[model samples]
Target: MRACFSLDTKTEAIPLVPLTPDTLASWLEAHPPRVRAWVEANGFKGKPNSLCTLPDEHGRIQGVLVGLDTEAPVWSVAGAARKLCPGTYRLDTDQDVAWLTQACIGWGLGAYRFDRYKSAEKPAPVLQLPEAVDADEVLQVVDATALVRDLVNTPAQDMMPEHLAEAARMLADAHGAVFSTVEGEALLSENFPCIHAVGRASSHAPRKVELNWGEDHHPRITLVGKGVCFDSGGLDIKPSNGMRQMKKDMGGAAHVLGLAKMIMAARLPVRLRVLIGAVENAISGDAFRPGDVLTSRKGLSIEIENTDAEGRLVLCDLLTEACEGEHKPDLLVDYATLTGAARVAVGTEIAATFTEDAPLYGELEEAATRLGDPVWRLPLHKPYRSSLESSVADIANCSSAPYGGAISAALFLQEFVDPQVPWVHFDVMAFNNRGRPGRPKGGEAMGLRAMFEVIRARFGG
Candidate 1:
């Protein structure tokens, strides 16, 4: 992935121009008037997502003009970037590069195509590096995002429970973090009963990936991700349409791991603990029934209201285990593609995040705002707690209420965390329904950067 930043203002050496339909006539009418001749010769229409090369009298390449429909749409400059000729260019006028800076970062991201299974005949187009952009930092962020997208985009056949654990192991090895995993029957012995029950039905088996780093004396930050590798919705089967993209259910793990990579790369000063409960909600004779009562790591029994709601089940145990661990962290955060209710509430682009800590929430919001990777905070209303009450078990995995489904899901996870601990839960819709700049219409890394920025600011880099 490669990128270049541009300014529209005129300069002696740098020659780049913004191509908009409204500006086309004025740009042609003014300065060096031959600019009009080039438009006439090429029949350049200046349509959105269009591109044209500018040349001198001898037909030597001078600069380039790109048509952007919406300036700074979360992932800007992503549409026509891949189609441009490979070279360095500058903008013809002055516009804020803050959005362009982030947009160009996304072009590097959209350029990513998973060619692991098969190779591409032509390599992705790489833009000449720009002076204003930190090429290395842009590549690092874009590459990390691609890493998460690639991990989630891979099919379950290649990305199973063991494979997810292997991904963690590789990350741990790269960063030199202490890595450990509780697998198969060991999950029961380790008191991860929900994880055991959900995974026991699969031949691939269920496991938890644990990676820890930083000094014990530093502030502790724990991340718990729900890694339901392939969700068939278990006995509570999903329709064909609903299950089509189930491979991305483990997107939470990808996000946490991606964020962890950024933290480790930047060498932030805080103890980081990552927990992933990797499982497959496959159908078999041994699958847990909807009416079954399962004990969790926290000793609370929960009744299954919907097997489709397994993300919360896996997270409940891991959250308790994380909070109860030695040297409890001041902050604990979990990310998951837990509910469709979230997508309904906030849509796909903005992930729904909630936190008990005001300062933490404010910092996260500011970080997202600064980085242009925004996440909207949803409240964890206490009145909704009654919706999760269970007659058979201590609680139910899902709520009976039709309203506030996203809120109820957050409340369910909140039950596992210690009351005094400041925590955040992100209910993210990790896939993009429509293609846009920087973000292609496929598996994407939503809240990874914003969360990383917040942690970096709250602690240190």
Candidate 2:
């Protein structure tokens, strides 16, 4: 269901049925005889999000009576609007007029139906916003969120490494950014050994796309996304069920690209550089196997304990390259659907963040709370460095022990990062298993908004 705020739109006033012990007394003073009778008969003791559709003598639907708890969060209105009949609805009171915009977004999010494979039974309800709310901001947020959802929902066949490069290219074209890509054997020649190793098995050649924009002198912000188009778990193959949703393995890249689009479109003043190490971890004769030793762009030799843990390998090279050029960004942030350990630590709802800089984490944490996009900061414990220690290579890509796998994974990435520079690594669960207000149950953007807010705050627009 979609909501639009316009006086021109057809809408009916919805009185919030108050929660009181004396329902009859509350009804007698506030509502008409018909409404009072209905409230008494139906036992409509006002409860949060409770709704009662008022009817006429002829039993036809007249209007809606909804209940609210004033103390609750604004998001409590989520999914409640969809329960009402499909039509334009307006608030009966003027005091909370500002809530109209937030409610509109909530209702719009509540009505999202990813009915790509099936049809929705009920039509979406429309909510009208009051004139005070900013319509343009609402539309912009919806557009960017829809972009994220659409990219995440698309299957791997349609969103492979090359296809992801096309997406990056399209965004570059839109903003007049300079776009360049390194593909196939060029990766080997260009020192992207890890990227080439992970993607060489796929029929479609993997590509690392780089897009740069804004004035060179501005505070630089580099975004690195792990774009594993489809992860088949390589030589260490996953079971059928485990590989079912591998299409969303590139959720991180999709989010970075989507956020970049929003930032560029909004004209945020940072010198932005977007790097996507797009690849497919597929199995073939040339697939890098378990126990294989590979050298990264940073010259760190990695022993592949499990080929499934290849996302970090791709990111390591891209990050190394991001730091190589003369115009290196002051801040580097990388997003990835990196490890199952992240989901285990914080679950699918929250993104796991790791950074050595406390101020960066504090700012990010505060921004996340403000934006309502939650992210939990995981530690980069120095002692966990032993978990990834390798007897043969410089380090093992996967840890020897399973405990603190998420921290070890972050520590693994820490090996490649410039210790002097500020960096935040996000292990994001890009998919939503259960639908929530403003979040649909499909491929979703987890930390995009929080990161954007932090970026904008650090380097003002």
Candidate 3:
């Protein structure tokens, strides 16, 4: 909800020069001897995200040099924003509107810091809005991204189910959208049995929060988020290290809320429905245990093979509800920090995306490539569904197989989704283990921009 950029019409803003390995030598050769000498002395070889400051005859800052990979991510300029001295800077190179937009976004993102709890914090270096960039669009992406980061960065103590619902309520209020919730025992009356079951043990009551906006005649877009506020792994329980960052277990909910904010802020033509099953998988006398049979809103009984696989249970009932009613959504997208197997398969930075729609997947791939958000496609292998087969229940919440955990998880959710509808599942690592140029070491929004692009293209603003 805070501004990410400051527009400056002044011509005296400091220049930021982006240089690739090939271009660095030539650019340095063109500069003054002292400037070139200082850069070489500092070991500035134009490596991606590397920076060097040029000084004038009076040792005053003249300009900044940012090293870039020829195929560097759009956020390459982020390092300069983060490391540079506080000053108003502008991109000095020639680039298209898209490139400028991405650069601005990178700068804005790098400027982010979660100082909500800190007593004192330094301000980020300022970036002047580029001339050709669409200010509104850039700000929308940055604000939504910041929202995701802020929500995910907050510890579970302050980010419980009630807090998550309050955040959704604020978003709905801001957009003049319809907001509703089925909390606690009401979840049972509403037939959200899986949601109720998974969340019943937590002192903070679990609920399904929904926000609806846009015209009724417009294309419908439904976004489902697995909002497991904290996962102590239920009665089965998680080890100490495993439970440490469980606060981010609700990354999926943060993602959808962030995406919803973007769509509504952009005033896209599509009617949007955002549903979050806010819950905490806490250990207690009432916590649902392994082997417990839970019936979903769709009447499918799920045998809980592992209480840690609680995200899918929260999502199943929400997805079932989304597919119902007069008009089905033209597109349904769900985000979850569902499986560590996905992180093992593609590492932490890349989101493991699963969708049956080839054409939609193609569009998403292109958008990811162009936008510099990375998402790797994994099969929703139907054969893996056998891994989830249970003799007593309609399905098992987890696979018996050790491998293909991500696939099995996708397949499990696929049961609740209608094949005719376009559905995408993003099993993302919402936390960055290490800091990168624009992405910090805390909560990161994976695949958000790429998914936003797909939605934007499908139903134009």
Candidate 4:
């Protein structure tokens, strides 16, 4: 919860000039001879995301030049944060509110490092809060993002169902929200049989963690997250490579927690309900197996075609529970690291989004485009619903066919949701496979900002 930026207490400006390839030569001519010589000597040709530091006459830090693309994205300024020496820095040029806000966010993201278990850690260079940016808004985004990263980065041994529940409890306690859980046999008694079945094998008990906040008069929004703490693919079993980073399987739960923190911290005018189905899919004699039929909370029977498809099983029960209240939520959003097919279709950078409601999808799309958080829409094809047909149960956990796996997964989940409620499901990667200027190579928060923007736009922020 540390602040990424502070007020510029000093009067001196450590000029940060963003230059593009086309304008590099002309801009270089305006600088002093020594600065120009340094730029040439170092071969600083203003390539996008490249940085060069200039020195004063006494060999002290003077200013910095950052390379940018012609149509530079807001995060282009992140290069300065990554490359700069440990000291206070400021933007030399005046920018609009949106640009400044994004630049600040990018700077914070670039400066982030997961050193929780490290023996030593290095401090990052600080950027002064620009006058154009809203400090609270930027900090909220940064803190929420950091929370997601921290939770996902943790090893499975440390981030079990109980640990995730405790995290939810802490967040709820911090915001004065009501927090509760249904654990072990309590889940079965509560009619969350599918959730209980998937998690019953692991030593760490499976549970549903719920957090409710905001006034009764406010608009209702419910968030459901699939919390597979560690997926060893259950009895079906995943390949060794597939199970390597299975610790991040709980990323969906982490994401919802992060988003919940943001909404509560911003004090958005909406009644928020967060439900996380926390469990670990492990090997044991009691592990749920393929061909097993489990009755869901919604009273729908699902035949397990593959135990590896456990995320949907957990989410279906949670979704059913979320929609059953006296007054249904105005909007129901769920996040899950549901399918490898989503990754195959869109890769890791874009979240594969599926929603039946057009208006809600439009809002999400617009928010993502505006915030530079990418989400690609994949169909919940009605025809694919037939692919999930089972001999005994109402539906199969996975499709009989291999193609359009992501679409089929969405269709399977759509069965649990009410047709009337506006719902959006994000199949997120929740990790940056390759590090970029601002995004590091580790557990990441995908679609979080865009989703938050949609909620803010719908309800008062």
lDDT score for residue 41 of model 1? 82
Ten contiguous residues minimizing lDDT sum, candidate 2: 15-24
lDDT of 2 by residue, 325-369 (tens): 677778999999998898999999999999988998899888777
For candidate 4, the lDDT comes to: 0.88
Query: Residue-wise lDDT of candidate 4 within 350-371, one digit each (tens)?
Result: 9999988888889888888877
Off by over 4 Å in 4: 1-4, 11-13, 69-72
Where does the lowest 10-residue lDDT sum fall in candidate 1?
2-11
Global lDDT of each model? Answer: 0.81, 0.79, 0.90, 0.88
Off by over 4 Å in 3: 1-4
Error of 2 at 416 (Å): 1.7
Top model number, TM-score: 3
Number of the top-ranking candidate, with lDDT as the measure: 3
RMSD of each: 3.7, 3.4, 1.3, 1.5
TM-score of 1: 0.89
**What is the Cα-based TM-score of model 2?**
0.88
Selected candidate, larger TM-score, 1 vs 2: 1
Model with the higher lDDT, candidate 2 or 3: 3
lDDT of 4 at 224: 94
Rank list by lDDT: 3, 4, 1, 2
Residue 92, model 4, lDDT: 70
